[model samples]
Target: MKHKIALITGSTSGIGLGIAEAFAAKGYNIIFNGLEENGSEIARKVAGQHQVDFLFSGANMLQPEALREMVAQGTEKFGSIDVLINNAGIQHVAAIEDFPEEKWNAIIGINLTAAFHLTKAVWPNMKAQKFGRIINIASAHGLFASEFKSAYVAAKHGIVGFTKTAALEGAPYNITANAICPGYVKTPLVEKQIADQAKAHNLPENEVVKKVILAKQAVKDFVPVSTIAELALFLASENATTLTGAALPVDGGWSAQ
Candidate 1:
């Protein structure tokens, strides 16, 4: 059998980076996606480390044409994209009354609509191969709400719904779509959230970390990016054929409670 190709969006940093590494570790030729000229550089480093073919395509995920072009270029380079990780997203924090229209549009456009566009763009290739693994990097916020996160909560909830529908459609074609909901990880985004929580609640950083964020989880620990990455690897594996349409939580038991 030929080596499978995996394309991971927003792979320059954070969860996307981790997922890329995980897929690479499993011997997948990686197609790294991010809106940076240096995206190919990052992919080169991973490819060198993993000894696999590497391809990169950068595009603003919000633009439909950019997304379509990116997918086209990626498939052309890699022959087929057997795995698609829709991990690009943005967040905005504000009460509904204070939410800016631009911010709301940006959040929804990148967080929710981009997934749909990418899915549509990649569906034909996946269907033709009758083999694909899609992993959407949703959030714990998808299943639950947080204060001052109106746009993020809404977009995440939309992601869960979209993942389900896409999974159902892809099922018959031997394609699997799933979402992974993670709790606070030590990424730059979550670090920003920690600082914002401190300022908003007028608490010390440590206090904000403990009481405001990790309080909901039974483990009360920040999730590691590797954990989510490992899950993505499993989902992409042929053994996980029965795992489609599942919203797996890597939340340190936050959603369980």
Candidate 2:
């Protein structure tokens, strides 16, 4: 039998990379898409360790055409994209009035629109095969709101809605769509937020992380990327067939509040 394939966007590092590693360990072939060029080594390493095929696409998620091409290349190489993980995203923190128009566009385009495009691109193949898993990496902001995060929050919320729509449409075809809302993973993105929050609040970085950045989280801890990866694997498994259209929160009680 042919090995299953997973196409994960923005999978060069952080949460995306974590998911890729988890899937590879499960013996799934992987197609990694991201703007970064440094993923070649990771691709080689994962493939070597798992003895599975790995491919990388330096596709800019901002462009819909590039995203379409990425999906096409993955399908062509692997014969099918059984799992789709939409994890590409960016962040910009500013009041709505101060938020640059370009920044809003970039965030919305990469974080929300790119997922739509990839899902659209892969829907037919998945529908035909009668088996597919669409896992979106949203955030805690998808469920709630925060200051200085209009665009990120909006984009994440939009993805949640989109995931539901996809789930409904895909239910008959045995394709599932779901979003993972994590509180705060200690990714480079959050690292930048630590610095920004420290500067903005005139607090030390350590204090900003504990007192400001994670102030709302009851656990006061960053959700591990591996934990999110485990969730992704579960969602992709047959055990989660009935769990579509869910916005499962891996947040440390952040969304509960």
Candidate 3:
């Protein structure tokens, strides 16, 4: 039997890479997309470790043409992309009045609009095959608001709404769409946010983490990337057909508050 393929963006490191390894271990071929220079090597390592077929693309999420070409290339190689994870994202933290116009545009473009383009690109093959898993990596801010994250918050909320719309439209086609909203995960992105939050709140990095970052999280620990990856696997499972349109939170009780 042919292996199902998963195309995950920004997967060279962090959460996306974790999910890639999990699916590869389950014998799924992978299409890895990221901007990291050693992404091909990283992809090769995971594929070798799991003995699965794989492809790597360093496509920029801000470029729709590049993203479309990526999907086309993966489809042509793997027959069909069975799972699509819209995981590429960038963030900037600043007050709305201080936020640069360029930053706003880039955030919205890469975070929210890229998901639309990729979903649209994969629609035909998924509709034809009648099996597709669209898992979006949204943030806790998708469900709640925070200061100095106007663009990121807006884009995440937009993606959550988009997930619901896709879920509704794909219900009849055996395609499922869902979003995973995570709290503070200590990835490079969040590391940068730690510094940004420190500056924004005029506190030390450690203080910012305790008083601002994890303040709303009932659990003081960071959400594990492995947990998020496992959830993504379940969402992509054949049994997950009925679990569509939900923005599931693995935020260490941050969502509970």
What tens-digit string does per-residue lDDT give for candidate 1 at 57-81? 7888879998899889888887888
Superposed Cα deviation of residue 129, candidate 1 (Å): 1.3
Sliding window of 10 residues with minimal summed lDDT for model 1: 89-98
Off by over 4 Å in 3: none
> How would the candidate models be sorted by TM-score, starting from the highest?
3, 2, 1
Per-residue lDDT over 61-115 for candidate 3, one digit per residue giving the tens place of the 0 to 100 score: 9899999999999999988999999998999999999999999999999999999
Candidates' lDDT values, in order? 0.88, 0.92, 0.95
User: Higher-lDDT candidate among 2 and 3?
Assistant: 3
Question: Mind giving the per-residue lDDT tens digits that candidate 2 earns over 1-257?
Answer: 67899999888888998899899999999998766667788788877888999989988998889889988999888889999999999998887788999999999999999999999999999999999999999998999998889999999999999999999999999999999999988999999988877766788987888888889898978999999999999999999999999999988998778
Q: How well does candidate 1 match the true structure, expressed as C-alpha RMSD?
A: 1.3
lDDT of 1 at 57: 76
Report, for all candidates in order, the number of backbone clashes: 0, 0, 0
TM-score of 3: 0.99
Model 1 per-residue lDDT at 201: 73
Lowest lDDT block of 10, candidate 2: 33-42
Q: Model 2 — TM-score against the truth?
A: 0.97
